[model samples]
Target: MAKFPLSDLRFYAVDTNVLIHDPNALFKFEEHRVVIPMVVLEELDKLKVGTTALAADARQAVRTLDSLLGAATPAEIMSGVAIIRAGGQALGTISILMPAQQSNLGLQPNSNDNLIINDLLVLKQSTEVADVVLVTKDINMRLKARGAGLSSEDYHNDQLISDMDSLATGYHHVVGSFWEQIEAIEPQRVSGDGYHQMNSATLQAILERKLYVNQFVYDDKEFVCRIYKEVGGLVTIELLNTALLMRQKAWGLAPRDLFQGMAMWLLFDPEIDLVALNGPAGSGKTILALACALEQTMESKDYRRIIATRSTRGLDEEIGFLPGTEAEKMQPWLGAFTDNLEALHAEDFDPGSSADYIGAKVPLQFKSLNFIRGRSFQQAFLIVDEAQNLTPHQIKTIVTRAGEGTKVVCLGNLAQIDTPYLSATSSGLTYMSERFKGFQHGGSISLQGVARSRLAAFAEAHL
Candidate 1:
């Protein structure tokens, strides 16, 4: 946990992702002297001209900045907000440090990241009067800033829940199972207090094993309620089957494997028309979803098509317009989907003609979330990757687009990262889990382990 001396900062360089994460970042840092690096503004400009959610946010930020500073000079203060235009904006009561040509730092062409570093270098060289810090989401950028003798820190807007156990306790509970032993107790009569008391895994074990309903399992000489069911319902059946198939196909799996059984369980619920999976990096959420999708599409015609999509959060800091068709524009973001498909095909399907088989049997369709609006899907299996980066409204739009018989699965690692304002608890994943709880048809599961490798698991746990 890195701590910052908030009162000591004189100048803060805002990164583009920081702005994209929260358009109101400017207002949030009202008392601080903020500087939108010339490169960052340029990156935001490119996003403002687009149709994606990030672009819309960038446009809003630009509007807010314009309103705050309507042509003021350096260090001129109005309404307690100081403004400076380096890259483009021509307004405000802040000092704009335009670096001389010699301070360019010779950044690579078309690299928004290099440009940002160059801008930071210029700010460091030009601003000899004010204390400056570089704020960004990119770890590499932060490292580069440090290397250049400038202070740097990650944007802290997306963190809503600091303690995982505290957040988990909100819905988790432990209680005695007296009601289960009582004959003729209606299922609907079971109170939420009883349900919330048990960890999902324990409840699931009781239900699957067909243990005596009212039998007391001694932990500390205390009786706990046993809520279990013998016959698995439709949703349970889908989840169990999918989990088993995924585990069988993927070798070297374990109980806590993030992308093996748990990922499948999270994504494949017959009752949940929409599902979301969030985890950190190397969790295998995407791989598991892709594997389950491939299994269903190949083994059974459960869905007409496998539609995979994601929102480009503008991780790259470039300003040039995207060239070519939608497919070309989407190539960068869809690389994960492609990689998962290739891995699955390499492991399960025949290698010599796997491409032909993928083309024929898989029929995986890739699209950006922006193009998903206004189209209703019927009998389709939809997977929304990187869902943590989306806003509640954007998530609502995606979920409502599901037509009859459409099952939508959302997968992302909350701890690994996301856009600003969306935290692990407040993200769409958490929202869906709370909203859909207790529906016999809907289910939610959180994956904890790294399934990729021992090193990956160690890194996830320690790094």
Candidate 2:
């Protein structure tokens, strides 16, 4: 399904942010004709002057355009350049829509957006295309295009799930009786490894409700939770050690709710390489991840260091080039890190040594996504907070950097995504959770309970 091509191809007018969000969106249109406005190139030129991800995407889009139209003549560019992928495979036709005589969009001639709309209108009037659809990520741009009597749509080629709420929570509750459900299936001793296996028919019966590997299944009647581990063709269920989980405390923090306990289990698992946590604000996502990372790095001595990072994109702030060292520059964006550190340090009243001790004991390092390329993190516990602001490409880049013996935990609230071009469904956090749910070394959990103060929870619900 990932490599499926579009069947009903049509002329698609792409916007600047669409190209910036996915650099390979040019080739994603399949056999359809893609029209690029000249003004989009102008926007890309201005955005390509930075070291940010947007700049990298803009440069990549320009390079892709150059590679597609490089050998073509001016007349060919006017008509269309055949879009070819690597290895010289023909995919589709791409063309540049140049500015012509005055258009009648009733907007100012100097407006760049109106000019693009006018170009699309010109194509609709002159070309034989059955439909001219403007594909963009900007809602306002789509509204304006539709207001001008032009068809518009969101570019959904990069989205993993159509609805983010349909994602798995890595857990299910079995009501009524637990023994009644398991009495009929006799557990066969698969090996001497303390794991009993269920028969194929029993596994099929369990899978009728759809269970993922390493997903937690709980029974309220029996007050037991088991971790479903699929091995060979049979399903193995292990009783969750709730007593051990309840007795454990990491970095002076404890799981206050059952969902938080589930999150902690996934976060601290040595076998699970990637853990994703989603919830609303004050759900203990950041705090629990930091606590587990600190435990794994400092107390358990499992990982060498804890690397904490998040997308610097903000709703009301921008991460412009600042005048300072790396640590000094990233200080503003590490407020969550600072807050969690303070929470951990609140247990100690010793002012002088408490801060220094936490810093020295927890081998933690802060990183910016800007300079994370071409780097490998080995024997490290990497926590990516506010992951909802990242694109799927950025998440892929970050996760692929994990060398051997590295665990990555991504935490975020889908409702709080602040990135310009990302939605709850299209965010990297949602994409990762959907794609990694069935993997043996991956687990995800949705933390529903808010662990913050009463006032905060009230505001989240009523305000």
**What TM-score, computed on C-alpha atoms, does each candidate reach?**
0.52, 0.91
lDDT of 1 by residue, 187-240 (tens): 323333333232333444434432222111221213332222233431111112
Q: Worst ten-residue run, lDDT, model 1?
A: 233-242
* TM-score of model 1 vs. true structure: 0.52
Total clashing residue pairs per candidate?
A: 10, 0
Model 1 regions more than 4 Å off: 1-50, 54-163, 166-266, 315-323, 348-352
Question: Which tens-of-lDDT digit does each residue in 1-463 have in candidate 2?
Answer: 0121334467888899889888889998888889898889999999987667667778888998898899999988876788888899998899888775665643456678788887777666665435778999988878888987789999888787788657888777766555466665654444555455675456446436666787876666534454557766667776664554565587778888777887887787799899999998999999999888888887789999989888867411335466677666777888888787787777676755776877776688888787776799999999988899988878898999999999999989999988778899888898899888789899898998677888889888987
Q: Any residue pairs clashing in model 2, and if so which?
A: none
Candidate topping TM-score: 2
Candidate 2 residues lying further than 4 Å off, grouped into runs, are: 1-9, 86-88, 184-194, 199-208, 222-228, 314-323
Please report the candidate that would top lDDT against the real structure. Answer: 2
**Collision pairs in model 1:** 21-420, 173-196, 173-197, 174-197, 176-225, 177-224, 177-225, 207-229, 279-413, 279-414
